[model samples]
Target: MANSNGSKAAARDKRQRLTAAAAEVLHRQGVERTTIADIAQLADVPVGNVYYYFKTKDDLVRAALSAHADHLSLKLAHLDRDPDPRARLGALVASWVERRDITARYGCPTGTLAVELDKREPDGIDTEVGQLFRTLVDWVAEQFRRLGQPDPHDLAITFVAANQGMSLLSNALRDPTIMIREGERLRRWLDDLPT
Candidate 1:
């Protein structure tokens, strides 16, 4: 039985809505406090339907993160628009600062998963979060390579750490300024590189 494009689109739309709603719930209430019923209500979908889409709460968490990671990947995957590596690297830094949703009540989904991973056994959710970080780092590294720089992997790791550090600053100060300053430092380093 083949499904029509329209039906598939609608299903995807529903899943996206559900994933977003679940993410919001996890962010606001903390993953430990979030419940499937709460996600269902927030999504305006029936409780049974939530379960139908996701077998368990962990499943919902992974799906939400997958969607979030994919959204970010789509946004910055083109971080190498410029032929110059330095320019591309700068763009990568700027993108993180510009797109960061500082007002997010929930922390980074990947960060949350990382913290949770340490407490619990290895699972799909932990793997998904790891993959997201790796993907982001790889993207950053690609830009560094374009610049003919050394240690692309280390540069990517630094960028990832700096981005996460900004989140902590944003949370503490309730301001996005710290990220701007950090982004400037990143650009300055690229500017100083030997031509």
Candidate 2:
């Protein structure tokens, strides 16, 4: 029984490692350029063992997307600790600024992946990609609603679009300062909004 438990734990660890590596690789290389081998190497697991965790590359991509969603959910949950809705939204923008260099280098992970998958033929994963955006939009809209804003959904959409647009421009321009400057602008915008 002890041995079985140990084996199960090890399997879970390996699966987590593979999923994490897949997310990183997919973000850096975009979906079309990443490979199972690349993820396996990053995870330090043998390529053959990757199959034990994931049957196909798409399965790995789905796992990455799910992992990304889980991560974003955790971040939103953390932001929820703040009492002020505007402060929470500002913190979200600040968090993006914190990763400005990475965003400049790779673009926004969720945004880039969604765009890449969108260009391909319809797959079930595309729906999951949409869910990521929905998660963000819903959370932001709720914050706007808390602030007594009309058309909270529209406000949230604009906020998310601005962040994504900044990320795209930063990446294209290879300039991390764009994220920093935009983050400051967003914080000011949030402050300016009437409560």
Candidate 3:
């Protein structure tokens, strides 16, 4: 029983590590360019073992997307600890600024993946990938609602669009400073909103 339990724990850890590595590799290399061998190498697991955890590349990709969603949720939950909705929005911008360099290099993880997947044949993966933005927009809209905004959803869409645009430009120009500058402007915009 002890050995069985230990083996189960070890297997779970390896699966988690593989998924985490998949996310990083997919983020850096894009979905079409990444291979199972690359993910296994990054995870330090044998390539053959990857199949033990994931039956196909799409399955692994799904796992990676799920991981990204989980991370996003946790980050939003952490931001929600702030009582002020405006401040929460500011913090969201601040978090983006914090990741400016990476976003500049990788073009916003969710955005890049969504674009790549959307280009592929209709497999429902594109729609699944789109939920990431929906999650962000919904969360942002909730914050605006808390601030008594008349059109919370529209405002949320504008805010997210601005951020996504900033990310795209920063990545295209290879300039992290774009994110910082845009973040500052977003912060000011949030501050100017009616309480």
Candidate 4:
């Protein structure tokens, strides 16, 4: 049992290393140019080791997306305990930008991964990425529900779309200020929503 657990842990570590490599490739060269060899080199594992863990490049891509999304989920989960939905919305947006810069190292990995994979075939990790967006949408919808809105789901989608749109534009412009300004506006609008 101990050996089994140890093997699982080792495999998990290896997977993380590969995912980190994928992120490095995606960041330095853009996803289209980044290749399995690039990731294997970054991870310092034999090129064969990559295939040992991930079936294909798309698999690795999805895993990378899932890793980053999980990180975001961890950051967002605690907001559920916050009493004021308005305050929660503000904090969620603030944390999204702050964490994106800090953890992502390059930028919002979510956006980059989505753009890279959107043109390709769907796979395991794309669902995880889709769910990440759904998470934000649901969070916003929950806020709307708290605010007595009739359609929390649709409202949530708009809120998330606005947030993602802002982030995408901010990344393109290479301006954190855009995210801050637009994020603040979104939060204020949420706060002003009638309860």
| Top lDDT hit | 2
Using all chains and alpha carbons, the TM-scores for the candidates as numbered come to: 0.83, 0.99, 0.98, 0.80
- Over 4 Å off, model 2: none
lDDT of 4 by residue, 61-122 (tens): 77677666677677668887788877887888887666444333345567666666666776
Q: CA shift at 180, candidate 1, in angstroms?
A: 2.1
Query: What digit string (tens of lDDT, one per residue) describes model 1 on residues 148-187?
Result: 7789889789878877877666656767777678778878
Scanning candidate 4 in windows of ten residues, the lowest lDDT window is 99-108
Model 3: per-residue Cα lDDT over 1-195, one tens digit each:
999999999999999999999999999999999999999999999999999999999988899999999999999999999999898999999999999999999999889999999889989878887998999999999999999999999999999999999999999999999999999999999989988
Model 1 ranges with Cα > 4 A deviation? 1-9, 99-105
lDDT of each: 0.75, 0.95, 0.94, 0.74
* Candidate 3 positional error at 5, Å: 0.9
**lDDT for 16 (candidate 2):** 98
| Residue-by-residue lDDT tens digits, candidate 2, 1-195 | 999999999999999999999999999998899999999999999999999989999999999998999999999999999999998999999999999999999999999999999998998898899999999999999999999999999999999999999999999999999999999998998999987
TM-score-wise, the better of 1 and 3 is: 3
Model 1 residue 142 lDDT? 82
The TM-score-based order of candidates, best leading, equals: 2, 3, 1, 4
Q: What TM-score does candidate 1 get on C-alpha atoms?
A: 0.83
In candidate 3, residue 26 scores what lDDT?
Answer: 98
